[model samples]
Target chain A: MVSELSPTPGARSVSADTEGPRPPMPVKMVIAGGFGVGKTTTVGAISEIEPLTTEASITSVAAGIDDLSHTPEKMTTTVAMDFGCVTLDPTLKLYLFGTPGQERFGFMWDDLVEGALGGLVIVDTRRLDDCYAAVDYFEHREIPFAVAVNAFDGKVEHDLNDVRWALDVGDHVPLTVFDARERGSVRDALLVVLEHALATAQQ
Target chain B: MTVGGGVTKAGTTREVKGEDEMTAGEPSAADDAWGVEHPPSIVRPFLLTAGRIAGGDSLVPTIPIETQVVATDLGLATLDAFVFDQHRDIITICRQPQSLAEIAAKLRMHLNVIRVLADDLRADGQLALYAPQAESARDATVLRRVIDGLRAIPDSRGAIRER
Candidate 1:
């Protein structure tokens, strides 16, 4: 590469203090569930920045049966995705991406899960089924995940055991009740997910 | 006083007013080469990548990039004025290693489009890619650091709500 012009003002200065032996690597943990399952709230609670949003285009091939012959053909469509982030430290930043919970968008998970620490699936007891897709997707991918039943107004509509059984999460999954709006609760819930992630990573 | 969950009595009441709204469905616009008069449409994403549906490399959003030595032979001047501007802006911002996601967000360009353009720049040796060192998602030491970091965060409950 050749230098055409001087770098723009405010370019990061490579100094002894700023440059470390190892460059800071970005790590991400996904916050996933249905559309309104407090994904953004959980991110905002823990993120030092105001949980900025970024969009990614997701393309998936759709297979459908032919109208007359009952044959299968494929189609593709692109959709937008929203995400947020947290700066854990100067060396390691954590990103929290709120993915579409619908199964149709499952094709995009492969990209989202690459190098991800783990996932926290926030479930609303009133809409337990809303999070099933997230749980199933994580389980199938062998990604460590914790199901956090988000409490609304400090109330849990369903029993923890019942919610667990309904979700069919294995005993290995740490299921807990948490308040998404509370930073401490969200932080604690993420801790559980990290513990699971650590155990999984060690194995 | 802060509650155990990090919320102050006053903060909780104020935050409770807003629920997660599906505001993404709202029609949004972006500036194009022509300025604000012609807001970018949905098809603009395709145009950004020159109809290239796929990107070349595994440039994850988190990967960091920095400008290498400048190359006069990169033929940057031969490209469209708008493209040259985008490339120059990217090169300027990436003088110090910046994450790919931040570049996309800051530029207001689609992540995929950034990936394609960044890949093009890398191929021309104008940018250097610094991939994450984590070999696997389950790296034990990295996960431990993550756990410790999350635990170290002081009570942030209602404090964030007010902002």
Candidate 2:
């Protein structure tokens, strides 16, 4: 009996038993915040896969090159951003990118936000002004965004309404509380941002 | 040993080793010197086919967000659908245990294009390369560690609600 193996549909036949084609999947989201506002933690929380971090040693030699005014206590700096992924639905994938809070990393913002659908600007109520740069950056670019107030313990005692008023957030913008340390909160915050984006896009 | 030097149709006298010096029914010394005594006939044809296929390289078929099988199979269709619409036709196409060249060819795109797409896809966790079969243990361990780490991290929302 002459039996021949046939190529399966959606599968390619190659001679060498060495390698096969790679399936394609890519998605991105930006995590923006003031210095030390827990952007990295928010990403690390809900990331289904190993998060790729670009945090590097803050050497004195490179101090002059990059600004570290906001996060003076930070020993490491996210030179670019932290990358992670989560599957929201059967066909929806979410990529979390933690943007460097320092102004010197400004050059990277354009590239990082290239194809991003929207962003989460993590805020520390204690240092609300610190997040102004991120807010302005995203706003000026006309990118959809949500303000996630990362409430740190013993730092501030303000209601969510106060935060909204202080931040001058319009009613249309979604304001939510987030703990950079918790995965569910971060996930919720991300969802809020995504929902806000979807709503805005609909209009 | 009988010594006879004669130039025939080839015009070159070749030194023939005796059966005693032959191993596995062939000249052991000559086989060792040449590395391969007799190469399989299929090698040339295979290489030629590979070359031809790679000639018109374009871009590898990246994991189509809407059309990706892995995401659907893994029950991540919702996530895949979201990403697919946001970034249409942007994905890293990887053949299972595929060679760099084969991947490049299958995409029908340039090697650099495939490479960039692959890098992005890998960074995004949409594709993974299968290493050595024996390294499954190591791969599993690494995957476990990553999952554990993710699980250990406290959910940010919990902290927010507490305050």
Candidate 3:
């Protein structure tokens, strides 16, 4: 980023604007799970501002298109995600982006997690299978991730150990019980993910 | 299993060798003259990007979708020096600094489209991009800062005002 906002060609002096207010250093955390896993709820809980639902027009290939050079028509899928920002301070900002609700947008994950701090995979106790793909993606890429079982009604249906065994996550991955509706609960859950990522990286 | 995918048609396409994943293949000159379109809105995103199609991370360097973007003095002042309306919209929305994703959400454009357009504006000195550190995920300092920041946020029920 330019150290100083450029002067408007003699209209304003270089010193007119001090501190060269550039955008803050971005820190991203992915909130991923299968459909209806409270992924959006988790983001809204802790974000300073209202969460925004954004759509991405993803161009994905349909089945049976083997010859790339010969094919002309293409399929474009619309994927919508919910995201919100927390201003860590003036110099840093943390963004929570919920992965697209649908599972087919697997190709979008590489772009989402490449430079992110880590991931918080939300799971509803009854449907543990919804998050398997997310867990696999993060683990396979060696990106540190934590699992938060969203106890929607404040009543957790199963033990944390049961979820661990079901998800088959290693002991290294932090598995915690959290209520998706509470701000503190989601915040602590995210901290666990960051701590896990930090610890994993240090080792 | 693509759910409700809309398969759009394409005409003859020319390959564009690019330096980053933001790159999209150029629409062949024969399809339509480059930079010459009837109206900006409702134009196919690929055509709006002039048919520059980008793919996975393995192929090219990329800006993390969360990178911040702000308008330059020039961008804040005028729409001249830019061909695409998307560039102009980026400049206008960026008068106050915003993340690339926010801009995409505001502009209702695809993330890659915003990436490509923002890259163009930055190249033209119309916008500035502040990407996170190269190894941000592994940066302990950044992680510590984020952890501290999260700690500072008020977690009380009152902290969350209904939107």
Candidate that scores best on DockQ: 3
Identify the superior model by TM-score, candidate 1 or candidate 3: 3
Q: Relative to the true structure, how large is the alpha-carbon lDDT of every model?
A: 0.57, 0.44, 0.67
CAPRI class assigned to model 2:
incorrect
TM-score of each: 0.70, 0.46, 0.76
Give the distance in Å from residue A66's predicted Cα in candidate 2 to where it truly belongs: 19
lDDT per residue as tens, model 3, A1-203: 22233433211111223122466677799998888788777888888766765544444443334343555754444456678899888878899988864454333366677788899999988888778878877887888899999888888999889899999999989999888878888988998999898897788
- Poorest stretch of ten by lDDT in candidate 3 chain B: B25-34
Ranked by DockQ from best down, the candidates are: 3, 1, 2
- For model 3, how big is the iRMS in angstroms? 10.3
Task: Summarize candidate 1's per-residue lDDT along A35-107 as a digit string, tens digits.
Answer: 6777777777776655544444332333221132343422222233445555567666676766645544333
Give each candidate's fraction of reference contacts reproduced: 0.26, 0.09, 0.36
Tens digit per residue, CA lDDT, model 1, B1-163: 1112332244222211211121222212210001112233343443444443332122233222221212122323433333445666666666555566667656665555566566556655555444544344667878877777777776653332111
**Candidate 3 local lDDT, B1-163, one digit each (tens):** 0112232234212222211222122212121111222222555565655554433421223556777777878667666655566777888888877887888766766576677667666766667776665677897878988888888776765463221
TM-score on B-chain, cand. 1: 0.50
Model 1 collision count: 9
Instruction: Please give the ranking of all candidate structures by TM-score, highest first, separated by commas.
Output: 3, 1, 2
